[model samples]
Target: MNKKIAASLASIVALSTLAAACGTPADTGTKTGGDATQAPAQKVKLTVWHNYSGDDLRAKAVRGQIDKFKAAHPEVELDAQAIPPDGYRQRLKTVAAANEMPDVFFTNSGSMIKEFYDGGLIQSIMPLLNKQTEWKNNFTPGAFDPLSFNNEVYAVPVNASVTSLFFYNKTLFEQNGVKVPKTWDELLAAVKTFKDKGITPISLGNKAAWLAQSSILSSLANRVTGTDWFLKAVKQDGAKFTDPEFVQALGLMKGLADAGAFQQGFNSLDNTQMEQYFISGKAAMMIDGAWALTNMAATGTKEQLDQIDVTVLPSVPGGKGDPNTISGGAGGGFAVSKKPTGKQLDAALELIYTISGPDGMKAVAEANQIVNYKMDVDQSKVTSLFYKAYNLTKSVTFTPVYDAYLSSQGAEAINNGLQELLMGGKPEDIAKKLQDAQAKSIGK
Candidate 1:
């Protein structure tokens, strides 16, 4: 047995001995159904903080799952606090400093998991999973990989947000006499055609650096190299970000920007504005994730919705990457605090199981959010081009989008350097700055 289980058994033995000596009834029920005695009942009220603002319909649907959990587990009361997505990381850090983190919380699966692991604030979900076989088998293998720290599972993934093709206005494409591009050269040709027709070839929102980092640069990285190379580079396994391939990727992005491929004022545009431009037929294509489908369906007309299309990104000529390779992973997953007691911890695990399992997966997917579980859901329920994007993502092996896979500080450094590069900083200068920051923060 591991240290935690051994200690828990020892404690239970001592407690049972004490109760027997005091002539009191021994609570001899086993945790894993053996001769071991049960731990004493301790009612707990857990506080869970999530960055699920009311404006996000998907977040609201997740909140509804929490409510269902509350109804089912009446003994455990949860105080669900919803924070805005923009400042959630800061808020979580502030709470952690106060030693006031909630018993159960929602967090990004990858870098956030690593940060909390380093801080000793989160507990491994492996122990809990050992007791819940059904729950353990529900998640896809790669889905849970991000939440593992030092080979131990720490979180349960709620959704898989993967990057895939986001093509714009079929009406505009047909009007401009352009077909959906299937190869990198074809894509460039389409861009030229759109430019000649006085329409923007793409809509890119670079105001928030990660947006551009994920959709364009990261997509190019995955295309130029395979997933393993990118992952190894991010993990700093004898790889450098200043390689010719990396430089070449950045140069390609610069070339596209210089050719009037992206919409005017792209540097100032936010995601919502870019989405609006696409829906209004102002841009011919937009590269984004599956989540945009939920947003588009909420606002666009039925005709407008029907005109949208999804496909895998085109394979680059002479590139090492596959056309089907996508950038994506599990986004928000559940993690319990290390400080909670056995019963409370078990309760929290139960809640996670309730939300991320089969029924919950189908419901959330029906609401247009991509799920990471392996069970089959009704495909007809999802009525948007988004499902096609999601299917394409699943059809390919996922390379970690840099923003999701890097250490938090490393991600910030790379994002900042990329932002400067987009705003006219030299590629070599940006590369040097990124390397220096990585060395300083992550130690070679």
Candidate 2:
């Protein structure tokens, strides 16, 4: 893998060195430096929505950039809302049907943004990128691929996300005399050990259906199906989701549930709440993406933060995929509404640049998240558990993030099916559902 691919948001953006690069107190990126655009005449009222309400530096990083834009453009009336992650997509969809998407909003690439673009509710960001030549040049090439449609960039990538990480508390592991699991069976045994000790083995919240698929099943499934099988499955080529390999991958998730690895009522919980269960010692481990690392560093107490470390899912028997690969890719980003034009368009463009541009990427990088930008951070002062997490990403390969690869209908079918799996639904049933939905999606 290339250095940029190896350096995911996982731990490549080490918190301590980032702290040094960002200042000990952390550069909030809220500084209203200088205007990137001319001051607006009439108050440019732009309603913006995003899913950065997590209790982490990632959220602060997003808001800080928004605050900076607000500060610099005093004449612009910017109404920014930090919506909950679980609800933002549905809420945005509802508004989009009414042609009421926020002038600026956080949006994931692929089908999510494509829906908006197809409806003429979204606008391309390439024009502004073309103007800021240096800023455009800094991003890792293909960073904008997911958001591009027929070469028109509808959005910009905000994170280089490795969608799944097996985060464990070292203190909990030591206390229970359990070492990190290296194989699937060992992982199951560790779950039994923790559960017997009256601790939740894993903290999971599937209230948002996507978490089970994107954060857990994506990476876990990859270990069984392998990248080659997966590529065929997505394209409905030689393999299908219902094939034995993919079925086995789905069974592993069911296996975790059967082992009682997750906390009670996990499906009823939200992802943000799940972090607290692990952070506060109620759970021994949490399976999440890179965002959880940012949350732990930003909110957990220093001592508790020190106890946390991350790893990839354990190897499964007869698995076809590389044990070192995790499910992830560049996904989350922001897009503009087609409603804006003239000065409003200029202000909206500036807003997008401010949030995902060079300065903006640096802000998020320091906030404990990684971006597609090739940064100039000094790694010499790194001294935290965060650095270890970065090393993990550097060593592994990233599998496809399902949402970024699957058809919208196929992605939804699997996401909802995962929720069903946690509730004791059949693995083969879910696999068959996905296979049918995806095959029909591609007319294959």
Candidate 3:
């Protein structure tokens, strides 16, 4: 079955089970236990939807937090439902259209937040944020940029993600006697060294399409022309992708692809297959997000994990850009629906506060050490390489990728264009198409 269909069906089953047990209408208020002489205060049930099905560990961690919230707030019953990550957005859309949205839900901070905000289905969190001093101080500058629309915050960021680096196999590099590259020229030379040593320099699984565009070009563009220019290009304000910087970046990507930097049949391999290639030493490097390290650690041996190292892509020679500029965003966050009542809202806010506060923030960061939250965690718990990547990101200027900054429609177009480009579409054609689509989207 399609992943989206399966998730939607699972959501239906969950909703049905809840309905059967409660025997209450969707909007019916819960009756609290109080004095019979006095009218009982109306109790509200808040539904929360999340997609955290990657592994039992993540699921258990999240459930533990939810259980803690439930034990503290008895009046506001929380109907927490976990959906498959692949089809979560589709299921959320279906729920919204049916007017059965949960009081609070999990969503990405970029175009997804904008869609919910424009539809008036979600509430603006700016007021709540402004009223809370501790919450405001918990985040770093640009941390809320993804959840902001027209200068109003609509969501609270719980975690941060960046596509600034890819993990490489140090053993492979050392065996091949190739030093890690710090410039585009050195990168090309290292690729040749790996090739001469009969090793695949890059393990890129383009079967998923977005992985290539999101994890590679997004960061490369930042390294090529700085974040401001890239953002301007995406926004169609005064920049174009056909300009020297973007064209050069695209050309470099093409050069690498043509030079056999990636493994054979890369376009046919899925993400898991590509990871296996790297883990088993068939490939030397893999372009992926920071989460890649955690996933590998969860399933690989300590020695295997120790062999991996993360670093930002090298700068282009003679390019007017800095190596310290990074491509990233606020990642996933929490948002509440506008239809929830005061008590339910209070409970949801409390839950959000707990999960995104200092303690929870530190836990999440320790789990995925690449996270950019301003929470402090014990350094002993994280790998040295993870700390290296985290500190590198901190010292850089980060910018959200196109999908995290563009409108929903525009983001889809960019994804499609990227796929086309990877499949041999001309760079000029892709640039022209993206620029035209962006202009049309912003006009509407």
Query: What would the TM-scores of all predictions be?
Result: 0.84, 0.85, 0.83
CA lDDT scores, all candidates in order: 0.75, 0.83, 0.73
RMSD of 3: 7.0
lDDT of 1: 0.75
In model 2, where do residues sit more than 4 Å from their true spots?
1-41, 376-383, 440-444
Model 1 Cα shift for residue 315 (angstroms):
2.1
Between the candidate structures 2 and 3, which one is better when assessed by TM-score? Answer: 2
What are the per-residue Cα lDDT tens digits for candidate 1 across 1-444? Answer: 899989987897798778767878544433655776565444467778787664444676788888899988767867888887657887888888888888888888777777888899998878767887786787777777888877788887788867655566788888888888877778888899999989999987767667777776777777886677777777677667777777777777666776778877777877767877887778889987766676676567767778888776777877778767667877678788877877778788877777776667766777677788876656676656756666666677766777777766767777777767766767777666666666566777
Give lDDT: candidate 2, residue 380: 41
- Compose the digit string of candidate 3's lDDT tens values, residues 408-430: 56666666776677666777777
Residues 1-444 of candidate 2: C-alpha lDDT, one tens digit per residue:
777656753363475346656556633334354764232233667888999886688788889999999999976899999998777888998998787788989898767887787788888888898999898888876778878888888888888877788889899999889999989999999999999999999999888788889888888888888888888888988989999888888888999999999998988988778988889989998889888778777768778877888888889888888888877767678888988898888999999899988888878877777677888544443226556676777788878888777887899899999999888999999999999999998898
**Model 2 poorest 10 in a row by lDDT:** 33-42
Residue 267 displacement (Å), model 3: 3.8
Candidate 3, overall lDDT? 0.73
